[model samples]
Target: MRRLLWPAAVLVLLLALNVFFTPSFLAIQVRDGHLYGSLIDILRFGAPLILVALGMTLVIATGGIDLSVGSVVAISGALACLRISEDAGVLAAVAPALGLCLLLGAWNGFLVAGVGIQPIIATLILMVAGRGLAQLITGGQIITVNDEAYKMIGGGYWLTVPFGVLIVLAVLAITAFLTRRLALGMLIESVGGNAEASRLAGIRSRGIIVMVYAFAALCAGVAGLMISSNVSSADGNNAGLWIELDAILAVVIGGTSLAGGRFSLAGTVLGALIIQTLTTTVYSIGVPPETTLLFKALVVTAVCLIQSPSFRAKVFRRRGGTAPPAAVAEEKARVREEVPPDGVRS
Candidate 1:
């Protein structure tokens, strides 16, 4: 709960800012039995990000990172759109795209786990090559799909809520269940904490690492479908571009350490929302398109600094605050032990 405090606070603050700038930011109206508002738009646009970050949380938890998710997103979207353009059935289009995503994941896992390449390098291989692969699949042109069913995956409504929102919720629920209701979370954490120790203890660290990478790719694939389906086309060059950075940022902002160990799905969700909200806020405030990146970078840096313990300590000291109670006690204990009771130093 405490770990989620900063992200929750930041999200609320951003939402409040939105409300102030755009009075209708929270206004939702039902038209044709479907909810509509800026808030809904945020959720809809942020859905893909949520999926990507969820997978990233697990990979980061395993002390590994997947830099290829953005590429995977492109490949998945391209393949799906290409099949649909070729008049393939919806299931036929989607199944093969998702299967290819898994194979891409396997390739990443093989390089990292089996071949012992560094994770960043292993994943980077795909990151650089994936766009080309997507371009090749689409013949360097945007593949447009006229399939309404496919578009529904990214844009339609259900029960007065965006279908994309429902998809996000379903993914979130399933991931939470898998991590919390089973030993999978523990195994991943163990591998992250100390792979050699976990291996000694009979945990299949390699297998777990491979599985996580594969799972991350699967999540990226789903996000690809959402993105391309939303637009009814796959632009291999631009689909999911730079999203990997955003997913990594979301994972970091969600209180997950790059060093690995414990993680919180709820935190990642909030982080994704915060990011989406921030993007919306930028547009609402009319930041120049040319300067938007600079503005966003500044805001992100501030958030990261605010979330840094060392930075907090510096701020606290400048405000005339002492160490925390536990730190004070530990320091006193150390001093007492260092200076013998009768003034005799050991």
Candidate 2:
């Protein structure tokens, strides 16, 4: 509960602001046997980010990053749509697209795990080339599909709630079970805490690293399917542009260190919701389209500053005085223990 304070507070603050700006923000009504409201829209639109961030949490926990998720998203959607456009059955389309995603993920894992490439550079290789491959698959044109069954994945409602929300919930539950309910989470933390030490201790660090990267790619692929299905089309150039940045931001804001170690899936979900709410709030407040990005950046920066312990400490020091000697010593000790000798950024 203590670990969740910042993200929870940020989420509440964003929702309160939305209520003030849009009186109907909290109102939910049943329409055609389905839920409809700003809140519902936030959850629906945020599902993709939630999925992507969940995978990212694990990758970051392994002291690695996957910059190619956005490109994988594009490639996933493009391949799925291309197959569908060619009269492939929906199952046929989905299976092949996921298989491709798995292969793409495996390739990334091979680079970082098998070939010993730095995680960033290894993933960046695909980040740059994957989008080009997506373009090639679609011939630089959007491929549209009209299959209702496929559209249900992203746009349909079930039990009066958006299907996308259900999908997110299911994935979250499964991931939590896998990571927390078993020893897998412990092994992952060990690897993140100190890869070489864990390796010597008999943990299969390489296999864990490969698994996480592949999982991140798999999540990105699912998000891609949702995005393409929502609009019934795949635009390789625009499908998931910059979404990787958003997922990274969500992970960081949720208290997951970029340097790696512990993580919280619930916090990541809240962060995603806050991001989605912020986007909706910007439009509801009638911020000019051209300046929306600027507004968002300002708000995000404020949130980050508020969440930073160092920033808070500095502000408190200016207002009052320094911490007791014991407290300062403890803080320094904790930092020294947590940070690696290589000066890895957290």
Candidate 3:
């Protein structure tokens, strides 16, 4: 909970800033039996990112990175859209897409776990090549489909809320159950903390690695479906472009170390919300298009610094009051050294 404070606070501040700009930023209304508001829009549109980051949280927890997730997103969306365009059932399109993503992830795991390639290099290979795969699937053209059932997955409403949000919730719940209620989370952490030690302790670190990579790819697959379904088209070149970076950033913001170990699904969710809200704030405040990325960078940097304990200590030290524990202890030791044996000031 403490770890989540900075991200939660930052999210709140961003939302408050938007209220200043849009005046009605917090106003949520139901129109024609559908909920509508800026906040609702953030949750709906950010659902895909939340899903991606959720998978990222697990992968990073296992001390690996999956650069290919963005490409997987493109490929998944392309293949699913292509199948649907061919008059395939929505189930047929989705199952195959997700299965392929799972295989792609397993391939990456094989390269890293089986072939002993560094994770970065292994995933990078797929990152570059998967785009071509997606292009091939879509024949270098956007595949547009008109399936109402498919659209419901990403853009439709359920119980007055975005169905995408519900999907995210379901995925999050399942992930939490798998990681928290079971032994899977601990095994992953152990593997990440020290692969050799875990192996010596009889944990199948290799299998865990494979499973997490596959899971990450699976999450990206779902995100791809959501993105393409929302738009009713899949662009091999543009679908989920650069989303991996955002997912990594969200994991970091959520207090997950890239070095791998402990993870918090709730924190990751909050981090994703913060990022989406930041995007909303930028658009609401009329930030110039060219400066948008730079603006986001600055804000993110501030939030990260606030979340860093060492950075906070440095700030406190420089403030000339409320010295950090180490500084206070040092000062006390110095005073004791200078004082006389009678406990009086020199």
Residue-pair clashes per candidate, as listed? Answer: 0, 0, 0
**Candidate number of the best TM-score:** 2
Using lDDT, give the best candidate's number. Answer: 3
Q: lDDT-based ranking, best first?
A: 3, 1, 2
TM-score between model 2 and native: 0.94
Tens digits of lDDT, candidate 1, 1-346: 7668878889999999988888888999999889989999999999999999999999999889999999999999999999999899889999999999999998898898899999999999999999899999999998888999999989889999999889989988988889999999999888887787789999999999999899999999999999999999999899999999999999988888787777889989988998899999999988899998898888888887776655665676667676555434534654563455777643
Q: Write the per-residue lDDT of candidate 2 for residues 1-346, one digit (tens) a residue.
A: 5446888898998889889888889999999999999999999999999999998899999888899999999999999999999998888998888888888988998898889999999999999999999999999999999999889889999999999899999999999999999999988888888888899999999999989988898999999999999999999899889999899889888877787888888888988888888999999889999999999999888887777666666776777797445445544654885887888943
Give the backbone clash total of model 1: 0
How do the predictions measure up, each by TM-score? 0.93, 0.94, 0.93
Cα deviation of 249 in candidate 2 (Å)? Answer: 0.2
Q: Please list the residue runs of candidate 3 whose C-alpha ends up more than 4 Å from where it truly belongs after superposition.
A: 321-346
User: Which residues of candidate 1, in runs, are more than 4 Å off?
Assistant: 323-346
Candidate closer to the true structure by lDDT (higher is better), 2 or 3: 3
User: What lDDT score goes with residue 141 in model 2?
Assistant: 96
Which is superior by TM-score, 1 or 2?
Answer: 2
Error of 2 at 281 (Å): 1.0
